[model samples]
Target: MSEFTNPGFEARFTLAQAETTPPEVLAKLAIDTHAKIRRAVALNPSTPIKSLLRLGKEFPNEIIENPIFFLLLLEDPESQFVRLSLARSTTTDEAKLIQLFEENDPDIRCAIAQNPNAPLSLLVRFVQESYQRYDDGSGTTEKVNRILRGFVQNPDTVASILEELAYLSDPELTQAVLQHPNVSETAIAIIQAMRGQRGIPSAILDQLVNHQHHYVRYVILAHPDLAPEHLLKLAEDTELYWDLLDRRETLPTLVIDRIAEKTFQILMSPAPALHAAEMIVLWIARHRNTSIALLQAFASNQPDYLYQHWGEQQFQNFRAAVARNSSTPTFVLRKLSRDLKAEVRDTAKTALRSRKLSES
Candidate 1:
């Protein structure tokens, strides 16, 4: 009962919890009779490496959860023990997980993928790497697939990540994602639709037509067999409009019209348009399928304010893009041939000559 035999346990615990406590004191407390006090020392950010190593044996989880543990890893990044411990711990913070992932150790990355707390961004990266490996017939295909399977099995995996995994077209991974309880109905429908040799069925297309998920709608839009009506319906979503304009596949004439109409409206609005809107207009001008009428509109359409605000170089760039479009009519090209910008005038004259040569 004496003070030496039984120090005030609560006071000792308080001392163990203080950041200002000396490292030597923490090292002593690391082996204190009270388990809770030792645990506190283990969790303390200020815990010295020697004491932490000892406590890690007794409380490995606590040691890995400590902020000092991450700092230790930073100092000794090649330490297998620290790297594996941090990678395997669900309590590891995103910053530490990012660092561990960069080590590019296959085993470490696999552990991070399996960790439920891994950030979605990291999970997406794993999926992309795995897809590349799978495509190239690389020797690490099996290991990367293991990483991807861990990603799909992780409870934190979202529908977007699942969609990305499904796109890998790996039969095993796709099946696992489809069967996963976390997969949404929208994701399931899209996955099933994508697997078919035939185009999206009307019934499923109807269900997904208004789906809120952008990836699902993007998949639907990318399907070569998608009907023109569905394509136009999806086009109404302003969020997808930018992506729609960038599609490499020839879009329906009506869809192109919709894009042209919307771009004009946004440019003509009283408020200033976003730089993204201008990019969309440029894409429309460059689209090979753009109708003559829309090309004519773009050829002549110049907002004085846009020219003034965007500066002469950018304005000339838009005209140059229009002049480069093969779909631009002869009359529009002739007009562009006289453009003040040398680049636009040269581009327009070249296109006009090409058209005449083809006709001859």
Candidate 2:
């Protein structure tokens, strides 16, 4: 028979949430008719391994998504499936992760290496394994290479691993390592030197600019030795411009000027929806070196188009933003200072005072 006679979902859910719920009852509730009850039981720390394992199989996503449950499932010896699921989970611990890596199965190691939480130890091991089995590069070697590629792509892979991978004689592997977000400045210098010796073409620079990995592109932008020409090139690339805007403060004056020119056009364009215009304005207003003319023009013309395009709250926010802009023209500030809403008026007055003090 069932543990609770015709129990409602609420009662089972409440029982599952109780820490003191007996192991037997927890086990029974894990298999309860309602998924909500099972969800609560999967979260409970005191739930027995058997019950948790059962939940892992029956409701794999629930077990995989919860760090607490996934870590416990990793420790279960009876279910390789459950353990493999933990290996794939982001929250799996380092010790179980190391154990998973040590196994002979390439698929298991690859799965672990792909996990964002794969610790440095696993990454180091994966890198070391990549160099081994150099015999004509058969099945295991190919799989290991794939695992190494996954490590290069994983954001959490350590900088040290990336630096070490930069020295590989294999050009493709070296290129992949360079594309990693964690690749250090020193490693980049070494790779550039190597590229010079190897006669690698300048087309690689264009490829790096368009790298699918945003962080990799960011690393290229932030490279200390990056040339003004390259920075300008990246700034002009439509795909990389937004990323350029994100780092606008630290960018060279020339690069920032170029970006501002493009962004101003986007802000002035009537074809793109008002939301896009507002986003550009926000970027311009928030960033350094925004043109005074741009701010004043937006402050003046935005209200008419903005009110028509924005909802009531959004329009209010736009007005408040205009009030806060120090670059907003004095006439616009004075107009906002007398606005009907007290909040908008107060913000304008404060900005006006600050602007006057700075001018003095």
Candidate 3:
């Protein structure tokens, strides 16, 4: 029997696994059979611009599904796809995000508010609009509040915006701000004061402690004026356990033990490949009190998956995340300091300096 190896065989095999194949290989596979292979090439971050453009003409859905390609589509300024995708992307550029905010499509505008990367100015504007429409006698208040809730949950929403929302007499709106991850201590204090001498009511605190957003729950757990009963209730929540451990220094001994046990259980569980989980692993790696056992667990799970799998723009983002991580090992920084991307190298050097200063 003849060997199954041929140049065409290699091309077909590599294109079949285009998700991990190199860009040069993907460039060759871009013109391969119509549906699956070309779609794979379109989704591959390393696919060349020419390949993407060719695919765009024939397979716009494939282009739309590829986030990097979607952003490039946005550059056209005339494509309706740009407006639609920009509405959903949390990573679109600030200027384009601003432009999307002004688009005539209210649905698209609402989507921009939902984007995690949406600017604080836009969020503040939405919150203000919600407040203004609260008593306008029209039915717009509920819709405006629904839209502003997205802004409230965004980490980018500034403390000033949260503070402003806290002053509003609407209990639901104020409660939403209190659950924000970025809500300042000063804003919490203002909210606490608004509730009168008895303290934030159990119902509101209960709801805030159970907020779906981890960062929001973290903020609530970190609040100095938090009610003792609320803290105990929050400590019992398995979902908030990591955030609780992340603030170990402030937690009571019993709470710390619970958090540690919960964290260890999660560590022993099968790890997921989700980006959010990977980020949490990196964060736990940075904590000063994280155990050697946990560090060993993370050694194989370093956030460098991005560097291995992503194209230029996404790789730079991964490098930036590593640079910002204070606990990123020195060896990693040394390697990153020589990265071809100037931003990556500069950020690495800056992080190294910060690490040195902190050590001293």
Candidate 4:
């Protein structure tokens, strides 16, 4: 094998064999031992988790019951490259991997807890158990939050499980996950999990709108039974511009009870119907052949909100509508022209000037 092909091959294989071997092989295995790991961290810090991941699929049950993986991150040469290589590992090595991760040093356990690819069941157990371990109640909430962020990134976990975390009364964990970088669509599950449940208030849901993740915003919008306040926030979160744009057409007509109330309320809520109207107007500006029904829906829902907006294109649009269809009432044109928004008033004036010219 070319030397390039075998980068760190010996260490990888050595790490691999320790996971699979009998007690006899495990001891003889030339791995840098736990003491070695602790000492290494004095110079270079990293998660000391080599033993559990090295075994691949055949890790011994003994190793599973008591993992040696956590010690690796404690060492200086924290080459988690070997560990991260095993991130999505399907190796039947779970028992040993988790045993060490769950039972060992807090730092090792945390590395596992933070891992995006750690087994969901093991991660959840670790998260829950670690919370209890911090019994002094000192700052355990922060610990739980760290685990929630890990799970938030993995989309495949059970919804019920994610919701369980939502039920945790720690405002810190709930709010932390709401804003976590790895957080995305999971906020929807968290919100739904909060349904009718007593602990979380509606304000936290509003905070999700400020998240950089639009998919999380989109998920909040996808909820049919969202609170009026939360719906208002999502409907108006400028960060959700693309989300509303993509789902605008279907949302208005998507089958829901009390269709008018939901649609109208979503469009007129206090947060800023401007988000909904502006996005649609922007879309209409791009695709003039847009379905008139959807366009008309906006016309009916938030025309007042439209006049309040600060964009020139919005006014230009009202003017263009007048020119395109003569039946457009003159009074509607007059209201838009007399509008206080200078850009809008200017555009409306230009439209009236053009209309009078053509008629003459």
Which candidate number maximizes TM-score?
A: 1
Query: What are the models' TM-scores?
Result: 0.49, 0.38, 0.32, 0.32
Candidate 2 stretches with Cα past 4 Å from truth are 1-215, 224-232, 237-242, 251-280, 303-308, 311-316, 326-332, 338-341, 357-360
Candidate 2: worst-modelled 10 consecutive residues by lDDT: 131-140
Candidate 1, after superposition: displacement of residue 204 in Å?
1.3
After superposition, candidate 1 runs with Cα above 4 Å error? 1-173, 177-189, 195-197, 268-275, 303-311
Candidate 2: Cα lDDT at 176? 77
Residue 52's lDDT in candidate 4: 38
lDDT of 3 by residue, 1-360 (tens): 122233465566565455666566677677876567777777776777667666654554566678675466657756555565555665568898787777646656666666667787876665555444433534345555676665576676778888757645557767888888888876675577555434555665666566544434555676555665666678666656556656545545444444444544454456623324334444454554444443333333333443334335654655555655555677777777887878878988998998889899
TM-score of 2: 0.38
Q: What are the lDDT figures for the candidates, one per model?
A: 0.74, 0.64, 0.60, 0.46
Name the lDDT of candidate 1: 0.74
Query: Which 10-residue span in candidate 4 carries the lowest summed lDDT?
Result: 38-47
Name the candidate, 1 or 2, with the larger lDDT value: 1
Q: Candidate 4's residue-wise lDDT over 1-360, tens digit each?
A: 242232354543443334333333332232444433322221221223343344322222222233233343345324443343233233435664575574455555655555445577766566556435333345455655666665655555555456445534456556655554444455544644444333344555555444334444554554444465554456555545455546544333222112323434455666644335444454443343334443343333345644554344555554445324333345555665665556656655776787889999
Candidate 3 lands at a TM-score of: 0.32
**Candidate with the larger TM-score of 1 and 2:** 1
Give each prediction's root-mean-square deviation over alpha carbons: 12.5, 17.6, 25.0, 15.1
Which tens-of-lDDT digit does each residue in 181-269 have in candidate 1? 78876667666776654655677776556654454566566666678888888878776787777763788778988976766666667
